[model samples]
Target: MNPTHHRRRQLRSVGTITAGAALAAVLAACGSTAGATAQNAGAGTSSGSSAAAGQPVSGGTLTLALDGDPTCIDPAQTSLTNTLSLGAQFTDTLVDQDFETGEIVPALAEKWEISDDATEFTFHLRDGVTFSDGTPLDAAAVKANFDGIIDLGAASFLGSSYLADYVGTDVVDDSTAKVTFKTPNVPFLQAAATATLGILSPATNKLTADERCQGELVGSGPFVLSKYDLTSQVVLTRRAGYAWPSAAAEHQGEAYVETVVLPIVKETGVRAGGLQSAEFDGIFQPAVQDQDALEQAGFTLTSRANPGNVQSLFANTFRPLVAEEAVRQAFQKAIDRDEFNATLFNARYAVPSSVLSPTTPGYTDLSADLVYDPEGAKALLDGAGWTVGADGIREKDGTKLVLKLLSSEATKSAAELTQNQLKEVGIGVEIEIPESSQSFKVRSAGDWDYTFSGLTRADPDTLRRDFWSGGQPNSAAHLTESPLDDKILAQKAEVDTEKRWAIVAEIQKEIITQGYDIPYGSQLQIYATRDGVQGLRLDASSRLRLYDTWVQASS
Candidate 1:
């Protein structure tokens, strides 16, 4: 338990960028303390790729494998990592935050200004940028995208949450657009850098949100979506005459990889095998046990910790088993986080200290509150009048202490482990792993006592989206109106970094202390690439940036 583990780690590398002095003041006031400038230094590239240190060579397809299929490919709607990663290839954001310095830099928008109150953001667009559909990227397009997200409502997922206090976006002129919020939103600039906020062609406004999920949307990115099939794969062909790239990109005219193919390989072992056999150029989320073998065979494993919600099991308060406050607190104490990580994952994963992952800004160290305490758990259950029955299961008022746990294939391992641990304290956990497409339907129906899930974002406001009562895409814990809701709302409007972070810290404390959510381990995005892959780097939000990624041809 080193004290340094609880402190924020410094960014490993540095690069210089020059913006206006006024922008510097905005970074100091709104970005610096809020972790808007914070860049992930935890990205590690293991030895073995043949072109790992070589100069880029263009014109080859990078056939990457994704562990899960994205339900939606629409930038405005998806919140899943795999979906956003795919979208990033075919979509571009308004601005780009530097991966090293976290400075706001030009992308589709050449320059921008933040009002003193942090409510209005004005952007000046670059000339001659057009979507693959021949639609010009202009202020009107930006307004259309924003207005569309607002119209989609919760279906827009992260986009709607990011634009929570949306007032409106004013089309100042052909090139300039001013986006104003009802309250001060310090996180909006960095939010703009995310793929979820990636701009789209105004023609997409005609499509319903579900139709957009079918992957017919056009974007002005380095690649174009040629095909999307749920059962097979999603293909992106290189966009010719493409000149726009994020300021953080290494080098770009068009993506060096000529055509990018993402095959939906749902099994982790199959993905690893595909990479090992050279059937795939890269694979996402190789199993922890397969890491050593993959690296030994000359494949490079790149990893970056996700910065929003940790891999957590959120209690459904509406469920009878977890409805009791004492029972919820007992469930937290009964599980051993260290054992869970050590058994299921390896050193690559971290034990989460708070509801928010350590890589997130405004993360508070709540390891003290999260320590393993089986004896304390037993006592709490006893005091709550639940007696251990002859079958070694807790019982009270003729009801067995069995709780239902909902999980997907990706989260099933952790859910199964949680079930085993809670059994030690006379609690019965019924595991229910549903199909990926059925996950949302099952969760929305409230058929389970606890659901295992996580989210990846660069800001602390992610907590608001997860725990706040009225948060977007629906709250994970299904929390109702409470003091926690007030704090979550307050932090969003408080533009002052220190004060806002203090409020975020309080929100974490309240979530942990009240037993609303139990974080088991931090979520890290890992990819295994074949020997010839080069220049692949992760963006600020841990999504793979493939603009500079190129694969060398075999000699």
Candidate 2:
């Protein structure tokens, strides 16, 4: 959201559509049956919780703690984990996909249709929807938001990759909006579900992108931002006349509680203590240690496997030692994924066997392709002719097999595990610890040889820019340029569903086989919540659909 936040500067819409009625066919084949039973399925949340077992409770403020601060309320231009805080108070996307099922349900626009050729999308806005500011939410307001993002050139990531050729949008009437692309973009439908594309009120659109940072934010949701002290806390009160666009939520009318406060408590220990002391009704406790205490106290713990977000070590291909295919293969085989998953995760995680996690559509079981084989690893390096020297360190033609690894100081555990894993393969890893901001600058400059990194993207296009090649998305050490990749990327926007997938699989194979995207480990967007909350859907994209949530007040 900052003017200087230019990581993937020249990127496109970064959408991954795979259209052509393929999704329709897939849904039809899967049938209309609900996969999980509601009685047992993980559904319920603090956001949509009712006051009683059946009745909607009219007023109460919900306070929460976070490990970090939200730098921007603009979803289109941020990547921090804290966007979940902003998401509740603001959103009006044409469609918000159920993060888990990838359902193209209503959000701001009640319904929509894609052109036969797939290049044009027409949205039918709901009749009575209004922004939190009380102004009518119309097509014109939606058009203004898109234009603002482009003219400002402020969305460094979205503009550069996914929306590179974002042409323009038009408002046909107060109820109709049309977004036309230069080509048939596969990711547009799905990207519309992301926070990056969340609709802004006409009021917010009037403020310059930079000027928006000076004060509180507004959104067309069940909650309203009542107070804000940028670096301290955000207080939101329920919109009394709220009318939801879809039946996805249980409480479709006015919210159950009166208010909710998102507090800026940044320490894990302190937040855990607050939850322990009942200083808060519920808190987001991510660590395993907090889970036990919460459960022991009769709190309900909700868990689900998250899709599209990955955590891994990306090698910088610029250094001569890491440039070879054999070295990358060796690095892959040397680490015991089970050891790390067991020791570090308490068996709560899976070793990432492929780039596409299990939650992603068309995800295949690729454990064989990711088997741990030390002897095979040594053979690959030997075949590449990197002889084992007397020091047990690898060397080829006087160049040492070495790299400088960098990551945020906050996630030191995963970063350190990567260090030990690479060392097992006879590679030398140098660690660099920088504060979150400076570390970001260091990675964007492509200055490191390898770093522990991950992305929380819902579609395959996210994988394309991250590892397919060139510029900012390629955090694979030093070799960041990709002309052939650029060639393949151009057609992705227009290709049909099946063909696009074939292309995506090709890109994944290319990155792995060519040693660009070093396959690391698979992970889910995990969370820890206390009991008393009920009926929240943890969507596949790892967001909590809080509309249906209800709670049992202390009797």
Candidate 3:
């Protein structure tokens, strides 16, 4: 059951690039907030062969349409996928994950080792690397970056969650640093491969967290944040002497594109139209309904399954109507996940059978309890002393079964569909589509009865981050002092992968049985590009890797 034990069998040979040779040359390069959110679906390869295919052509600007403006460009501060996508363009992590095999590979740190107890992580930094501001990226810089995240406290929601159980970091030398944890942190190694834990320049780290969010942060990546217009766009220019690229990067030199312009296109229709008309070279979160038209127009659609938590309608148990276990269970049973996926995602996305997506390591099938049973839901509501009123909404003790549902604009359609589905079972839901950052604020404040969201991480430990009472963004059903918390903590500290998997399975069962979360399906991280664009890749975590992407001239 130890997922890593089966990693050898799961190791897939991808493209013509061997990881060992890539790392030896890396002597090398470097390296979401969506609950494993929606991405376009296609085979995991670059799109179209043209004059610019096969080799990277080092010029031309790549304009991408983003579904929303980034909440913040600071990697240590925001967890939203839009912001994470922007972060990837200008920040570098200590490690990287192979897009195909999900293997951990070298990036900023040439190599790393973990202690037997799993409490100590020692990283050997690559020499001669420097941040955009001409600052050396040494071990102290890495420590400063982590220390900055620790200093942000609750402000660094996603970043702080990744560094849980931290004792402190020790800079052994210019090229060496040792990170110590009070408890075994089996997820830290993979967390280091994420953008949230990416290293920043010490000069930028010296700024207050608020200052960094205002665009003061710097990194040793392939691009520099040349312009940031909060309401309009973000502009990045390729770094001149950038050489260190992640082992998973398509090339080991400067980025092929001279610049990347990420324009905020909040509406899916606008994004799809822009890509089809060539007003934008690429777009994120294209509408599923637009896939066929885009293909007919000679555009290529691509997506990869996000490898983490499944998309679910999270009920806020702290709310009065949802406070009853029976009510929550009724809500779970009322959801028709099959119909939801079919209508919103077509067949490209997988309907989740458990809280975790199939792509996640140690995932287990837990679909029996997830079947759609409208009658069973009604019975549960009736048993809880709820009766349907003449108006169709259920009533219990003078309280109507009406709840406010919050979601981002990206998920509004699905939220509306859910509203209709829940109505069929005598529950009334009012949907609210807020801006992405505002939506997170409302969910974190526990101000809404339910919210639709998901987080994407290759590690199963994401469960701890999402469900632990002490977790960052701690938005899990307000269940404190439950045995579930104990199991979650145990899994986090369990170094043996197999035992950890068992503990996670138990935790998933507990959540499902207790009706803590109502999972619907996994999200396919999709993107659309004009034909002849090459080297676009979605990493294992579903964020874009565009460092080596190139635009071929139209024939």
Give per-residue CA lDDT, model 2, range 1-555, as digits (tens).
Answer: 532222112111221122212223322443333212121112122211212234544455555565566666555556664565356445656777654356567877778888866678889888888888788888998887777667656444663355556777889998998888777676778777766666777677677665555444567777776766667876667777888645345446876666767776665545544544445455553455444444444444455544553566777776666667788778777767787776566444566666666565435445676677888888898888877777777888898777677867645766677678766667777778887667767777766776776666557666655665554543333454665466446535644667776666665555555555555555544443434444544554566545444444542
lDDT of 1 by residue, 204-306 (tens): 8779988899998899999999999986898999999999897887786978888989988776555654554467888887767666555555567777778
Ranking by TM-score: 1, 3, 2
Off by over 4 Å in 3: 1-52, 319-323, 382-404, 407-412, 430-448
How well does candidate 1 match the true structure in TM-score terms?
0.86
All models: lDDT?
0.79, 0.60, 0.77
Tally clashes: model 3.
12
Candidate of highest TM-score: 1
Q: Write the per-residue lDDT of candidate 3 for residues 361-408, one digit (tens) a residue.
A: 667788898999999999999998999999999997798999888877
Q: Candidate 1: worst 10 consecutive residues by lDDT?
A: 7-16
Model 1 Cα shift for residue 554 (angstroms): 2.4
Better of 2 and 3 by TM-score: 3
RMSD of 3: 11.8
Q: Which ranking of candidates, highest lDDT first?
A: 1, 3, 2
Q: Count the backbone clashes (under 3 Å) in each candidate.
A: 0, 42, 12
